[model samples]
Target: MLQNFLVPDVLTHNYLVNGFCKSGDLETAKWIIIDMLCRGPSPNCATYNTLMVGYCASNDLDKALDLLSTMSTCAIRPNRVTCNILVHALCNKGLLGEATKLLGEILEDKPESKTANLITSTILMNGYFKNGDISSALAIWEEISKGHRTRDVVAYNVMIHGAGLSLHHSLAYRFVCEMYKKGLMPDVFTYNALLSLLFKEKKTTEACYIHGVMSKMGVPPNIISYRVLIQGLCINGDVDLAKEYLHIMLEDSVLPDIYIWNSLIDGYGRHGDVQQAFYIRDQMVASGIFPNIFTYNALINAIAREGKLVEAHNLKTEMIFHGVYPDVVTYNILIGAACRLRHVHIGLLLHDEMLKKGCHPDIITYTQLLKGFCLIGKVINAEILFDQMISSGLMIDHVPFQIIIKKHWRMGELDKAFENYQIWLRRDK
Candidate 1:
């Protein structure tokens, strides 16, 4: 097509450029832009912005910024879209300082620039909250509230969500009240945020009240809403109440997903009601929601926690029958259980099985196995496992160090124990 079309217009060039950019072929996209410049219809600002966005998406932010400079040199004035692409990329990468500087520069250049609009402000505020700079996030919102940027429902949601995430439940509630004063209705996201905060704070009555308000407000509860409530109730050790919500969801024709079932199963399993957990799993299967790795893992973890190693292992076979192979988490739960039961032999067997099944152990796997060895008074074996963990490019935490220290002290090796304790102290620093 390129051979037949002698002179491709700017639009055609941009079309090809966008295709390459979206496909993550930034190098090819750049070459095409250069080819367009060498040919006719020199690239425009949109052309440059497309390539810049591509660069940012590829995580080559430095190159993207350089392209922005090139745009200025070529007398192609960048618009708000160009600024937002860079700001969002920086914010997403957790480079909040750089993002703030860039945003300030864009606002100075174009005060009316939509680049400093609600979306970008929300992004900046979210970055601040995530970085533990809540004061900065509140300051940004103060500016928005003062009419620097048009305050919208989404902007309110961001602040509310951020407050909840930062563990400021009272502030989150205040924000919701403020939203009502501003004549803005809270959406499902807003409720989810508040509900999650309330649940975490053990304000179950308040969370349930908000759920009632949601129904009154005509914002039909979503699957996420149900999931959050169920999980929260389960977390508070109210599996029976959580199961009631599940029944209500079913009555409302809201088909529950695997996660919903898994939460209840885990709740019941953790409460030492293995029968109830299995009943939930049976209900899940009846609902045509096939148990996945997560379902079986929950069951295995629950049974393992109850010191039912044989039952947990039996569930592993059942999991395989359902075509779900054991992952590292499954083995870790079993290994931890075996250690707690003083069955180090079974834990070692599971470790070898994980290796034979091509499932590499992670840090938790090594840590659990080390603890098992240490608990069994096999300090030499624990040391070997610890060394192997470090050689595999994994860092050792104080848990392993403490195990070694305690074991040494028990064996009356005072010097060795003190030496390991010093090493642990330095590592902590």
Candidate 2:
């Protein structure tokens, strides 16, 4: 344990940096690296890479990139791992140009990194797709395929998944066939991508067919696979089929997570099946998956729409009892319902409670409350609320003006009503 007798290895020092960075202690992580430089166990590429990753994780990407200069000062050349990490972080931040430039610099410095280039290219392609530049992503794919490097399933997956997300059916299918032609087997990701695309296209028949194909081809669907299947089906208004897939998922030994349950509950609620929504909530709890705010929101929305305000209020109270405190969405739904029913006092109380709980009210929240107060002839309260909305810098259209003018007109204040009418007319124009 004597520091002088046995200095920590480079791996141990890197671990300390990783631990500190993960805990949001970048200062300590940097101090550890400085200590290594001042004392023994000279830092290596991995050590600086660890520190760079920490900087990136902490959102100080400039400092992370600066570590490259420090690495050079220490006479350590940054390797492909370092390049890939920075490239990935850059892509995630939507800095595609910067990422591309950095990748070029790395490849120019060391041109023998075929495998590393392929992986980084996939990340860049994905980044392009996310930024909605499908052509750029395809251009990246073309480069990879044209190169001598053998295209792996992962590269193909990135292309196919990108195409799927962008709803490019032709590209997704073309990639699937290309994978086969190149003698690369499609993994679970490949099929999942296809299924997702089919759902977006509303080709439910093809999606189901692909699910069957996955089973026959022995590409076992993971939790994400089933989730996409059920979620897409539920979204396309096939809650019944989605429920069937849930049973199939359990049979496949994939435990349904909270997301899956919430999707099903929301789907049934949307389908106007209040009892079924609650039934799903109970089943979710019975499976040892606690119902989250989303679960209760769907349930509350379903019944609240049916004029069952009491039941909806009780459910809101129950959310707190179960430790799922009401969020902005929760209050919004209740407040909107109360306004609809002309129960403006209930909406007011909910608004106050929302603020006390530190849930910031959005424009929708302010708009709803403003309409409620105006409807109940509380013009002073309505005006005060409107000032608060303007102070909050909320952007909205003429809807607020429409409410103000109508309220003033009903109160027989034609001059005030006419003034707002002019402003609304000019603003709308």
Candidate 3:
């Protein structure tokens, strides 16, 4: 196409650049933009805005800012769209201060750009919520309510989800009620967000009440709603009620996904009911639902907790046979189990397996292994692993370092213990 055309129009260039950006080929997109500029086709506000949006979408904030500056130099004034894109990118990166500053500048320039106002306000409010500044979020909400005649459902949903994540479930419920007063019906997302909070707080009775209210209001419960409710019940150790909900979901023809099964299995495992948990797993397999990593982890950890090493080891073998590769969490559980059973050789073997699978052990994994070594009086091995962790660029935080230091101290290795203490102090400073 380029060979036939002596020069491409600005619209054609904009379209191609946007296509590249959307496909995440930012370098190619930039090349196309440069080609357009070299061809002497004057770039307009829309062209600059499109490029800025692309940069923001790609999370190239620095490049986006540079483009913003270039836009001004090119004498193509940025539109509301451009400002909103920048604000959104800043918020997404957790640069709330910068986002707020850009927003202030935009509002100061054009107080009546309601489109920019709405978009920026939503981004800023969400950023505040994410930063755990509920006071700031509420203030922004009040500002929006005062300015706009009607708030969008998205704004309300963000507030609800943010509140829930922050453990202010009651405030989230109040937002729902407020939405009701404004004649804005709660959608599936709204219910899901509130239900997730209820579950997080273990407010089973309130969750059930919400379920009833949802049914009474003729709001159809989606798969997410059911999943959240079931998971919540499971997390609260109400496995019987979780099972009841599972049955209800099956009867309602809402297919139980892997996550739901994992939650149920994890719940049962937490309650030390390995048999019931395996029963659920069997049902899952019978229903043709393939078990994922979480499934195997739950079962392995549960059986290991019961001192059923043979059964747990068999499950690990079955997991590999099924091609569901274990993750770091799985290795941690296996190592912990082996440690509890005094099977140091087996634990070390699992550690080697983790390395063979190219799965790097995280701090928790190392911590568990360290405890295992300490328990078995293998201080030298623990020290070696600790050094390996540091050499691998893992941060030697105070807790784990202190644990190793104390262990060495107890063993009368004063020099090594003091050296570790000095390292911790240096890092702390």
Model 2 lDDT per residue over 221-241, tens place: 889888888999999999989
- Deviating ranges (above 4 Å) for candidate 2: 1-32, 366-392, 397-429
Clashing residue pairs for model 1:
none
lDDT (Cα, tens digit) per residue for candidate 3, span 1-429? 569876777888788878888888888878876776777577777777777888887677898999989988888887777888888888889888898888878777856657568777888888888888888888888987787635877789999998887778788889889898988988778888888887787789999788768877778788889888988888787888989989988898889888899999989998999889999999999989989988999899888888888888788889999998889988888888888777878888888989998998788777777877887898888889888877887766666797898898998989999999888788789
Each model's lDDT:
0.86, 0.87, 0.84
Cα lDDT of candidate 2 equals 0.87
Among residues 3 or more apart in sequence or in different chains, the pairs in candidate 3 whose N, CA or C atoms overlap within 3 Å are none
TM-score per candidate: 0.79, 0.85, 0.77
Candidate 3: list runs displaced more than 4 Å: 1-15, 38-44, 112-115, 145-149, 215-218, 247-257, 273-290, 352-429
- Model number with the top TM-score: 2
Q: Against the true structure, candidate 1 has what lDDT?
A: 0.86
Better of 1 and 3 by TM-score: 1
Reference-based TM-score, model 1? 0.79
